[model samples]
Target: MAVDIRTQGLQKPVSVAEYLFARLYEIGIRSVHGVPGDFNLVALDFLPKAKLKWVGSVNELNAAYAADGYARTNGIGALITTFGVGELSAMNGIAGSFSEHVPVVHIVGCPSTVSQRNGMLLHHTLGNGDFSVFANMSSQVTCELAKLNKPAEIADQIDNALRECWIRSRPVYLMLPTDMVEKKIEGARLDQPIDLSEPPNDPEREDYVVDVVLRYLHAAKNPVMLVDACAIRHRVLGEVRDLIEKTKLPVFVTPMGKGAIDESSPTYGGVYAGTGSQPGVAERVESSDLVLSIGALKSDFNTTGFSYRTSQLKTIDFHSTHCVVRYSEYPGVTMRGVLRKVTERVDVGKLAKQHEVTKVVNEVAENRDSSDTITQAFFWPRVGEYLKENDIVVTETGTANFGIWETKYPRGVTGVTQILWGSIGWSLPAAQGAALAAKDMGVDRRTILFVGDGSFQLTCQEVAVMIRHNLKITIFLIYNEGFTIERFIHGMEAEYNDISRWQYTEVPTVFGASDKQVRKFIVKTKHELEKLLTDKEFNEAGGLQFVELWMPKEDAPRALRITTEVAARNNAKAE
Candidate 1:
């Protein structure tokens, strides 16, 4: 049913672009990221009118990655691109957002409806006059697709797509024909905010599931709580914390769930990724009689090559859309309500009597060697000590991602990684987006990034975007001379893993940052690294800081070493 604009007391009609941008502003998007193209150029004009800043990125792919990062921090993000070429270039990044459950609105400015009706050959198209091809490709990765052809229906379509993107926590594709940019739509519709609330779970079903969970939870002598990435993606940290604090159960996080829990908590155990767990973490988790797994995503990298020893018979899983009690499944019963109800109804006295709270002490290995060279074992722990609360840390897929497992974060810290997607060049642009978001939200949180030299080369130009926005980000570029993580897997000495060396410290200046606006450092020895880490001026620099930390080509994080070996064996077996 079409909504009658005149009946809604709407006297003025706004262009489709105006209506779209206004809705984005209402949803908390302050900055729009993308490149300028012929089709989207007019739509870009409406950004300023909507009180949205345009973050012109180096390319479409990086723009999508930045949108992913922005969405992670700002709650929701949007991007604008041209018809075919622009949207296709951003496919990989959009796919990453889909796989990792990030909410991003990918708006593509396409050809005019007249051009499409006549089957006109477009410059950015596949040269087949087939305009629907690109949108078809995007449909595979995006949760919702909105094609704006009619002015009357365009407003509703945009609202529905954005609603789906937010509620599902995934990317959505919006195709706006160039001709529709000026087509007037009902502006009064913007007065009503899109309903962003998650649908309430069935009350009766929720009660039954909560009872089943409590029965197992109270019956087990050894019960533990395991947290994972979906907990953060689905916005259930508060509920998870409530359950943990009320129950006082031993809480552990998986690798992808690094920053999900406050590590400073007394009952907080270290990361547990099966055999890749910290010291005794695997033993404690696997031996538990009842394991309450919250928002668990058991990916290969997250589980250390599928090495979880915990049995399904002993586990009860809490998910965003469903709950599982051992082998029985309850669909549509989300964790947000269940966890909250469980925390309220759980018998704290009975739990305390049934199980003894075991404090898992996180022990960092000391630098036994008197040599001045920096090692992975020493660097990660030292970095952990340097990190402050509420900091945003972005790590690349290779070594930095796995190395972060050893670095216990402070309370309130947020981690950004692509373990499931494993995109190499994601963190640089992501860090830029995160820093920009922090600035926009007026939060004093510092944005930090850790990227390998090989991965950095892929999207190093994004540093220019950071400089353009004057984001105060700290970047630690590991100079290992090659892909260290790949070497551990199969290419121990392959030339394909090697990368050309560059003066990494000179990047900020080349990226248009003034000397006062940037700080650069090169640390080879342990002494040099320690001095830089402790320097108050370096830590509190008013502008961007880039450090080239030199490590041996062969050295890799302990967790990375084990997981890669397992991956190699699996690949060989498949061959």
Candidate 2:
């Protein structure tokens, strides 16, 4: 690719968009998810010319979710929006991406450098002293945040943003002032493997980790592997699974990390925290002598708010920091690098025998189906039936939501979730973005969306976009009257938890089709949901279709325990 070059004095500079996009191409990103804005005109101008498609979004929140799905599936996700209003709108989604350990680049165009120097009021701002304060607010949500303030500092600034995100493993932000774009600067070197810090580890914590892991490894009669989604994002699933397979440790997943290893494996203990989580899974973790938690977060939902645990005394918690042993609550070895080394020492033959034993236990749990009101007891296995070898699924947060659907994804199906944000209303918009990607990739597989009513309402407008493009998607909407997770919180049960209910199946026709294009279905019971999923009329529809299933407004699900725990902690922190 070649571009305009301008020379000034002896200093070297480049267009801000060129500098940023070059960094992106260097990192192997070819497509981005975003809605164009006047502030980001430079990107809008150059991205298409560089053969990058701007996957437009209906709203900022959806933009974040869409970007997240793209990045999660394809390895690098990008989102661009205008200044204050746009950035603020996207905060929640990007934060969720951060929580899920998705490597996403958020590029926002802001008031030009000169506009900042004028100190004049801009439209739709909070009247804060400095316009850059908006970036500070975004800083609270992103992993790394910065403003490209001067012509000379732009290259190093962009480089630092990419490098820090690469090093620390979280979302990062680059706030671009309009004027600084397209300024001639040295051809900024793109972000590469060579441009990062040494392993971010605390050398002082090595002994702490050494003692804890070895104790657990030796003491475990039935050790279990608790892998969270972060482990997959860190690209350590194979290594972690290798350790588990070698040691023959049974494995379980948090909702965020579902399907990290083949859930069908004999050693799989099943999902520990979600609507469809197996009962024995949690009890087994609590009963075990050791719990090897790899990249597993003790989130409110993922861990029942960390309320439940395996052997508290001998627990092995591996995260971004040191391996923390429960005995002293002290940091140990840098969990990332140390896990690589320790897993290598595991015994494969012994591990295989252990897996055989767990396989029997797993079969028993899988066979005990019931008609109780438990949602996980109801939906997950059915989800497993619908998935194909190359299907893609997107989930949104809500009551009786996608949290615990025991889905059996085919060999390469990508499961996308908003583990960090966990906010309702992300699925529909995100599914639209994912569909766009599927179209772009020319993959014939269908996209499935498991969404809650509350979340669907938030991003329902995007259905028109899906229909306009004739994207293939199957949406299973869980119809609950309110935010199911909120009711789990202590005092949010009454008016605050209630949400307006709409004619759910009528949504697709209402939003996506005129008299001629809309096709829809109403699923009052499980049978209807099953039929719609299987019937050719429903599945083969080229335009848009909606399937609505009525669910209890009050039935307690496992994720509720998680939400209650996390919400309380967050609320307490707020206080």
Candidate 3:
């Protein structure tokens, strides 16, 4: 006899706002981050009352970044904002989250259904009559679902939208019109539990891929392994690392996939495409006997628009879609299934490590620490030291763009970064989503954010969300004024590199992040910074601490130093 010990809830119908709000609790959302607007006041009303906190942001872009970062570290990040202006402001961050596959729920407030037909030129309406701009723009980076026309379908629409998010492992949006938030609706009642578990591979297709890949592997002598953000985000690091070890192939991580395997590992060949490339390594990639790109988007940015010619041998680009072999034999099948079958046949451990390849992996790590400032150099190593068991870290496009060169992590943990869609203000709210997801899954993990001052100002309002939910977060604000990275891009020459200086210490107080019991911190120097970061008072969970490091405007940490140096030279040449 077997017993089912499960928690049960009382069944009762709830209004659209109630049901949707309840679903947040069901999915384990503790707080909502973003600015309020007329269109979204319905959900806003119930948020505080129901014990779910609502955080108001100064701007939509930062709110989106906060939500994205919250999700990267916490899971199920939530952001709510008004119509056109707010939604449009959040575009950059939201799109980045979608590209990075960070699970987030963006609740955008829109004009009422009645208003859609009135032709009255609603307050938030764009120059064009179509409201689809919000949905369409988001659709490119991540998928979105919305229906302002149907009041009764609101709850169900939200439920289905979240379900699709689980399936795709990326960001999803649910547009809510101001009038429909409190409308009546029948909540979706599914008898079958939503399975978060991944399904087993297709046997036949699995065998086919393994056989084809095995044939290629056995023939190649100097095959190079390439992996990207997708592999890292899916928590497939171990499996991927296992495949690398089994084949004894040299591994090259993408900027986002830096820590999938310890950057210090003998098999590590540091990141390619973006980060510093070793002297002969870039050429090696070109002349590699076999190139295996697994779970890699091979985004144009990653390969310099696929610039390096690899015509001498072959490329086995393994993706969710059909596999492209040597850019010739394109076959249909899942890459994981292929790996599964291949593992069944080959004794990968017997592949014997390649000495020359191993040498390259070792050489790459030495060049990773490119940051010049000694005190400022703590970015990645400090990040590595702070790594917890399955801890979620949300990094914005700039921080993520530069890549945590000195950062380290365990074999298969999760992190979120906006690589393709370089969105500045996404890390914050995304961390909220990650926290929400973690709490729901009963996982004890802290959310951390590595962001700069110029970007941090964008979504400064999420501090309220942290306060309301009692979510513990450690946020780092490197106070170097202006858009640091953009200064290196050709014409700007630091012209647009300016931001209003604010007391970084006042963020928590201004946003009400400081309740009677919780505390916040602001550290300026190397000594004070290290003590605060390492001290007992600063690390406690549920405390919102801001360590503000005052650096000259020049203290910008570029992930790709080579490119920055080149840009500097180009700027000098022009002058």
Candidate 4:
């Protein structure tokens, strides 16, 4: 009963691998990342025909992490891995992408369909002849799953999986068997690009939600807009910005939502994370009569251990899937449409007039100690001074992540972090991916990474990949002994929280870069860092630059101290 696709199609045929790669190219994935394996060896041959570049990574986990970062910057990304061992190695990275709402396509080159039907034992298999185990495990982390075993249905499955990955902004699992890679499918379907648009909201429900938002907006004497991580993930920055500009409401961002708004704007307020917020930010947000929370993910870290003082009755939440005005929920009405409609119809005069804006100065007191040691308070704001507009700043989930709250970003800068997932070793490889993505997009932006000693040691081998690709990135290796964040959370003097130190500034050279291709510096004092930050040649370096920033082991960011204290209490609390 199978109808051959060749007779049904009016045009030429292409191999399944060719069709899949072509689809990936059309969706703006210029670079595919993964480690090469025997199962995926033949399929990797079709990359060039589709104009895709295979970025050979050091390991599958780093490759998946890079893909996640690339997807965040380049709109969509993909990675290829072998079955069983290779796929399982990338699962942690995939789960992080899922938790963070980044769209990444995970393609696994599995054993042949024939091998599965005949119950033949394979090397990567469990030796029990069960081929469904890995796919079943991947189903837990991905939004869509596509098994391309049947030739006639392959094209639709590929397109559908990709479409869902884009719309939902989460990872998707695609299983490509070794034998099916060469199976012929219709090539004419490649002419039409995959429809990547989100489904439109129902007209009636959307209108009602917009009206309700407007009514509350006009009635409130004091209202504020709180932007969060999903605003960037869901591709609604334009709508959010339009609403912000038209209404001129006091805008604040959560820790996870950092860099979503232009911090240079007059309406921009500082970050508000309950008691961990900047000066006057908590009072301003908690006192507002109406809080328009956009795309909020109130994770424990994001909320500073759930310390938010604002009442839900006073909050109107706007999300990717639904809208809530106060306590009234309007399902199926997305924020993008509602934000657009409200921006187009908002009455600026009816909204409360702006009071004298209190400018929150984040500058810390200068180091008064005679040792001239760089403290966390002094280092972060100094980093803020060194940052340029449009730069992509990557922070590791340790002190770098918590310290960044005090470093206000310039206009157009994109902040990347794993605040919700709290993955320790994500920033280094992620920076590599972000830099490659920026280059692929042809944007003139510096890729900067701030990673602690412990996190850098986990994925430092990715520096070789960056060197091989000749990517321009600035990496500030914060040497504060060991896992400072974990030490603050528990076991301040415990041996388990310690790590051996490395001579970090020599990494680029060790990674096989020439002297001219790398610049290295070690700063142990405040004056040394300031001099390097102001140097024109160092700031505008042509190749990879490494800076080792030495700081006191006991010193931690104020927000980190607060959040860790709360976490320690929660961990020790009796059930």
The candidate scoring highest on lDDT is 4
Model 3: what TM-score? 0.77
Q: Report the CA-based lDDT of candidate 3 relative to the real structure.
A: 0.63
Candidate 4 lDDT for residue 140: 94
TM-score of each: 0.97, 0.84, 0.77, 0.98
User: How big is the RMSD of model 1?
Assistant: 2.5
Residue-by-residue lDDT tens digits, candidate 1, 1-575: 99755435545688899999999999899999999999999999988999999999999999999999998888889899999889988999999999999999999999999999988987998888898999999999999999999886898999999999988999999999999998888887887899999999999999999999988888888899999989989899999998888888898999888899999888887898998886578888998999999989999899999999999999999998899999999999999999999999998877744344454433445643788888888888778888999999999998899888888799999999999999889999999999999999999998999999999999999999999999989999999998888899978899999999899999888888888888889999988998998999877756799999999999998889999998998888943
Over 4 Å off, model 1 = 1-10, 352-365
lDDT of each: 0.90, 0.69, 0.63, 0.91
Q: Worst lDDT window (10 residues) for model 3? A: 3-12
Error of 4 at 555 (Å): 0.8
Cα error, residue 396 of model 2, in Å, equals 2.1
lDDT of 4: 0.91
lDDT of 2 by residue, 332-434 (tens): 3456666765665544444323534242122214524444332544566566666776667887775534444345555667777775567678777777777
Best by TM-score: 4
Give the lDDT ranking, best first.
Answer: 4, 1, 2, 3
Positional deviation of residue 135's Cα in model 4 after best superposition, in angstroms: 0.9
Q: Write the per-residue lDDT of candidate 3 for residues 364-453, one digit (tens) a residue.
A: 234344443324345455656656656666666553456454466654446556667765655666565556556645667666777778
